[model samples]
Target: MPGQPSAYHPGPRPTTPRRHDVIILGSGIAGSTLGAILAKQGVSVLLLDGGVHPRFAVGESTTHYTLKLFRLLARRYGVPELEPLTSYVGYRDQIAPTSGTKRHFGFIRHEEGQEPDPAEFLQFSPPSKGLQTSHLFRQDSDAYLLHTAIRHGCDVRQGIPVENVELEEDYVAVIDKNGDRYEGRYLVDASGFRSPVADHLALRKPPKDLKHHSRSMFTHMVGVRPTDECLRVGPEDAPPIPWVEGTMHHLFERGWFWSIPFNNTPDSRNPLISVGLTLDERLYPKPDDNNPEAEFREFAARFPAVERLFKEARTVRPWVSAGRIQYASSQTVGHRWCLMSHAGGFIDPLYSRGLANTAELINSLVWRILDALAEDDFDEERFRYVEELQQGLIRYNDELVNCSFISFTDHALWNAVYRIWCAAEVPINLRFDRFTERFLESGDDRVLREMEKTAYPGLPVPGSHGYKALFDEMVRLCEAVDRGERAAADAGKDLMTTVQNSPVVLEHLGIRDPNRRFVYPKPEDLRRMAHWLRHEGPRELSYLTTGVGVHGRPLPSALDEELAVPH
Candidate 1:
């Protein structure tokens, strides 16, 4: 059963709290996740946010690995078991056409540098069992996250905007919008880009934009059903009850759109479709909320593809807009006070990375701050670890972005470009492997035990060597991609195939257990038939046939989820 947050606690809360272990501002993914981690650690945490529960939000995409994370959160909290959520049919059950399923398998349209990378979307729809379970984001994720944090004992106070913070010798005191104060040993800026703590402490200087991907503006709708014209395009099948991403750019250039659906209950009048326009700023001007309709008109006039997508479509009410953003923290951490700078402050949604990064960062930082407070002193070393965690995250995005960049280029030289970029991002990958590493490494096991209590599972991911090979091969493949060699056309595909065939891949993908140690069909073993691989699609590669369509049983159903592991 959910915790009794339904209890009507009395009004007239205290004005100034003397002290707590830590103070977190922002209740989005990062703040909530970190709050949960810290609370479970037995640390007294104060989390203040600007919004109420189950508020409207936009981002919903997740890679193949997100299922494990969500499962972990569910188990940790006292919520019902995650199995139902995982196998929930809401996404496929939306009231759209039958063929309206998109990303049936996970999709990864990788573009190296602003170019279309078709194969980047994962192999096909329904990639694996738990794969479809990940589709229910945006709608249920927030409440799921908030309750989890509360279960961990986070002192979450919502709808209170923080106004000022004073860093004292022993503790930092924060003033809310109405001048009430709360004090704590450490201050965490899980506050998204709309950070009051960072602003109060002046932790941020000018932010430097990293390798930006593109921008997006979205709005909610109801009764906007999917059509056949939408289906034949990329990344859309029917109105997915959970979520749908449409890469209009793959079908057209510089034009991208997506549709995410949810149950129409409570707040909404009808099922909504999140229609969007994602494009490079270099090509079209940014949309202005000051006059979004006018800004959109300007874009439609200038960009033909975007015009066509929105021209005929009827967008329902509750129109919302968001920037497809990317950027690096100016100084996420400083001397006395540091910013746990969660989602809103970092880069935008290119590979659907924002929410995962947000939750992970929060969980990591809150644990660190809690540990530092437990010691009766601020553990600078733990904060340093927090810094490393965020840096590692940024590096992962860098690699992912560059992977899309090179994949999109499709230039003969792209292989080299990709390889070199991968070389750089590998170490970060090794360091930022999982949230478990962050929770377990803390000297104080209190937070960790709480995490364990919550049922967060370890993401059965690859080890360092697999990561190193991936990075090295990425560079090598980029170089290979550049050479335009016969054997190098789609080196990414070959590498993925080889890795999937590896013992570790089988284990990570849940194909075969490591203890049992069953060997897979090796890339080298299949090299004899490279001639046919030259002209095959993901569907063709889904088989285990002999040369030139030699008949074989269909590939394992698990291959969709298990083998197509994201780096």
Candidate 2:
């Protein structure tokens, strides 16, 4: 009965609704992963998916924070299978062998009818060479997670769309397209844009106030050449990492193009590449023809280097075109139902924050769900923090990406604003890394729980006043540029000045200096940062000193010795 859903029942279909402790719509990675954790914990779960496995899906990138969350989830929930997803080595060996290894995040800015300028680029790698990230082959990864849930005793239904969600005083019922009913103590809609829980509750609302406005069209493809091979840059002008080894962003004035290759690694069996173009709908209005392929070519043709990068590409599936991909809900939870992650809202995929946000939501929400199940309490008040966290994450991302899009108009502005993002990303990763390292060392749930009892619940660097000030100023400057009240050049100059003086700016990275185009911290840089953290770093970042490991070595002296370079 555990692995069986209504779709795969061998015997006669039950007339009575199937009952479970939790009923989740959409068996994508989010729902399946949640299902696996809950099922392993002895919570009866039913996972419903309208689609099947090995399907083409986007959002294929991962950050250090994302992978760390995977490790934490695996250890904390006792789901050892998830351990493989926490690193490139584990994923390549135990999971999808063809998944891409992401060593760095690279952005190359281009202008109309011109080759990319070597100086007008940015590359940021995790400080340690050993801490590799990944470009997910989502189809395989999603299927793997779903089956993991099944093996852990979570029932699943595939190819059955939920037609309606009925929420009552005690339980929730899901009615499928074929008139089958499923009942559970609680319902969670991890289903994307067309979330039945959101629809039933009339919670889906267009985020018109959201400053970020973008349309996206994406598909998996073969024959797309890597930028390293396509671009005519000399070794002296090359980025710190090969462009093919990570997610590449080809930025222009009004939009950006992403290239994620699954064929980057040596043992990779997959030759497919994930390709997409996202444009600010306000700047590049949708045309009447609605041809995504033609539109992609037209945009690429403007940037000479970008055109060569995708010249040989062939789409394996029809491109998915979306309009203004931002959406928010009036509420993410009700009496006995909740909208999980993307079901609640979504911004653009500029920084690959989707999965990271999903991880945060799961980490924060699951404990509450487990406790409520134990207590038999379904009060909406119990989930107030989850809603707030979701909203805060969305709000923060909206400004970050909205400013990023605005900054794309000029290289100087983009350089300054880019550092603003690093200010938040670096510290937050360190914070999570430190806590995760401590938990792994001590096997203490309290270490992970300590992360939740923070004043800023959903943010990466919630306690840093300097980060907040920098982010606030960035929003102000970008908003001023948007209003045509401030020139982009002047704003960039002002931001650079502020970044130079900002306490959140890590001195060793030289991000505050506009001349440093690539931010790759060496072992010595880590040692310097460790020293700074111990002495000069802000008091708010003191939490970063607790068991923070770098490149498989502990902080301070241990890291220094492990990474010592010969004189």
Candidate 3:
């Protein structure tokens, strides 16, 4: 149920005064994972969460980049338990058995009353089988991580509602509802949206700064039909990977529907499927009835295919809805405290970047915090880079999701924008994978700082000049479409021209035929693409930009005056 609280499990009461190296707010995966890492390093850490584990939660998807980051973190920090959750095979063997394997990501565009066109369907498969991710059963995942943290010697207390947090020059004091006080050298907030630390510190920023605006209604259900079976596309037209074998998205003009299966395996006991409807509130306003399940059914019925898929599904829990899922913080770090990536801000779930962002932030912050502790400094200025990284990720997600909403309104724009997204996504993942591998080989923290410098909003690393220029142009065109300043057809044509002329995007994406436009490369092809990117891609940037549309174009004098590359 939406606001129903779980049964509070009162653990041992705290009587004696104690001080730890760090006091963490919230025992969610982010907080627990960070605590476990620090505790494993012999640091005294305490994690507190208002809600109990095995409770309902969302953000249930993962990606290749997420897997890579997890593996890197585990290997770098000596947390073998986390390495298991990085892949489908490992997750099943080591983690919970209730999770689902995500071999590919599938999307289908639908009209109001008509079945979706097979030609408009898009499926994105990861490069290799080892890199295949999973649809995380967050309840199980969170509980497992909490146990992992406890096993690592982190002092954890559940059902402890935090009342106030006091930040001092040398330590932080946390007061609970019962007026009990806990103190530690540093405070970290990992509680999602309702962050007591952020609220008390007055660090929240206006959500209007985000380009994306959305509301969601979601719940766990049973009996969702397989997407491929429901769609009934011809064998020849079917995706190389089965649509039902991964997280499926049913996209429409004003919104999108997510169908994530949790019982894809035969041994799986959980039959529940996590389903959600996200609507652009500006285009589709909520009904006044205030019934989430009813509103979900009414909205799902608008598309015939979605209606059929959910015909036999029955909700196992009450549906939950939110007014707006976008939020930001004016500051993510203070004199003696900081907010987790999610605790600071969240844009949307359009690309399943939540987990990836969370893992990446934890990885970076862990090292920074250790460094700060070694130097006996907890100044906010020391952690400003963490703030930049978090805000930069939110800005990137905002642009991606907001522009994606515009693409959904027109098939032509969708096709072009989807390609552009893939182009940006592939190389970015490849770069991060390589960067992590290198950092693992050489334990130099500077490698990470240098890698962070290359961070251009979305891509994992700062790519070639040609790649940046191409992506920037695409963003400009998409932003124009988002604002209704450009027609979809015209933008599509321009995007196609850009794709046709740019070999970096085309070759990286394995888009050999511009006419066919949709190509699913073999695993071997992707492997070769990664190899080329690491060895020869950087040296060829000048040649790659030779025939680009923006290349050699005379810039306006005012624009030239404003353009200066940072040192």
Candidate 4:
């Protein structure tokens, strides 16, 4: 990780006889999570990692959804009451100028003379600005997860760096830095930013999925809160929280900042805060990288508010760091192999999606692998299904991330209207939460409906278009306001008018069909249909009904073939 996540030749296996059901590489969250899950299934999992976790790392602010998975995992592992060892009281972001605000739509920076076109906004977009601290990486979190992994039945091997895997006739063999050989029936590439197995086996390559606007640097400091001031002069929220906190992120001209809440100490009457600021190279410079640490301290000194947090903040002893904000390898799996690569490899961390996406991969892929080994036959159908599911999830997340950060070119006029319409109360608008819920309850039909719904909400939603047309009118109003037709007040008034008249107006734009019923998974009948297909085996139409495998491809040989022999 000191180097960006990549591969290194692990040399050769020591040619000793070692065996296990599964071989895992990397001990970061993704790999550890996988090891624990498999071990719980009563499978023998040999988890390998180059070094220990709690290494210099960032990208803390986790979303509400992450807790849900933790809850589920805890329940399954018999830890009924697991509190967040590390929790974000709220999320925070460093308020700053996003490329979208400058490039895509015209914007009135709270300052002045800042009008950005849409294209630039899309290229270098950041989430709409707001907040300060997030409670994502409060040391307790890393410790908690490692503890949980150990609590489960995982066999963790730290400082045992895995170089690559030899996809063998039966079992997959692992070779480490010191020429140790171990083989497992299955190989899981949970290697983080550095995907050793993926790189070695040529299963996938890292993709430069980023554009002109990507630079990230972060370090955690304790005492990020103000001990000297109360609400009178300090921020409204306590430090040790996440991006949803107060003006923490809302007061910047360049990239976003994150100050997370963390526990103080194992012994004592206080808690500490973890502060992180992510600035793009475009604005925050590394002009004199000769001493980046001194430069950062000097930079923080320039911004009084930012400086206050640092000056008062505590360093959690041996603060750590690594570059996390970058593109992920676009491809994950092939016919005979797959990857468990998480850690912002295929996505961005703007919405605190890194962890949530990681959970998604584990929840989907881990089980299929377990069931495969259990049945002594890898369910090729299930593998393909999970594979596609992973792809779909990636594509969906890419959209959300890209859409949220895309140049705010249309922010004032066009962009603002599009995003705001989502906030509007349309007759049958499917909110994002609704889409996620449906996806969980039932996989395929629900997913398709979500696709159509999110794809074209105005046409897709029953009573949303009046709002859509209202935005087109808004652009016209923007031109008028610029020309002094009415006041900026008049344009603001129009926005309200549209809001008030939305239902009727949307009817004109095609919202009044009057028959907005649920459009997915037609009840138990389909499930019974799926049950029938499941028993039919690979040739059965049963799998079709369940949405459990790839639609067009045959079941994978690993899944459809005979029992795997031990090496």
- Maximum-TM-score candidate: 2
Error of 4 at 441 (Å): 12
| lDDT tens digits, residue span 124-240, model 3 | 764543566888888888888889999998888899999998988888999988898889878899999999988998888877777888999999999999898788567877877
Q: Please write out the lDDT profile of model 1 over residues 156-202, one tens digit for every residue.
A: 88898887888777778788888888887677766666677556655
Question: What shift in Å separates residue 341 of candidate 4 from its native position after superposition?
Answer: 4.5
User: How far off is residue 520 in model 4, in Å?
Assistant: 30
Task: Go through the candidates in order and give each one's C-alpha lDDT.
Answer: 0.46, 0.82, 0.76, 0.44
Error of 2 at 429 (Å): 1.6
lDDT of 2 by residue, 1-567 (tens): 221111211233235438888898988879999999888888888999898887877789999788878877888888999888877888888887879988888999888998888988798776543446888899888989999999998888999988988999988999999999889889889998899888888887767767789999999889898899878878888877888898998898868999998899888888999999999898899888999999998998898888888888889999999888998888898888889999999989998999989988888778778878877888999888888888888888888899999999988788988988876766887777667666665565666666766666565577677688888899999899989999998998998899989887876876877888778777687778778877998787766655554334554432343235421
**TM-score for all models, in order of appearance:** 0.62, 0.93, 0.89, 0.58
Angstrom error of the Cα, residue 523, model 2: value is: 0.2
Q: Flag regions of model 4 displaced more than 4 Å.
A: 1-17, 53-56, 76-139, 202-208, 226-254, 263-271, 282-285, 288-290, 314-324, 335-337, 341-346, 379-381, 389-567
Worst 10 residues of 2 by lDDT: 1-10
Query: Per-residue alpha-carbon lDDT of model 4 for 308-390, expressed as tens digits?
Result: 54776646555333343544454565433467646225555444556655665665566556556655554346566445555
Q: What lDDT, from 0 to 1, does candidate 3 have?
A: 0.76
Q: Which 10 successive residues of model 3 have the least lDDT summed? A: 558-567
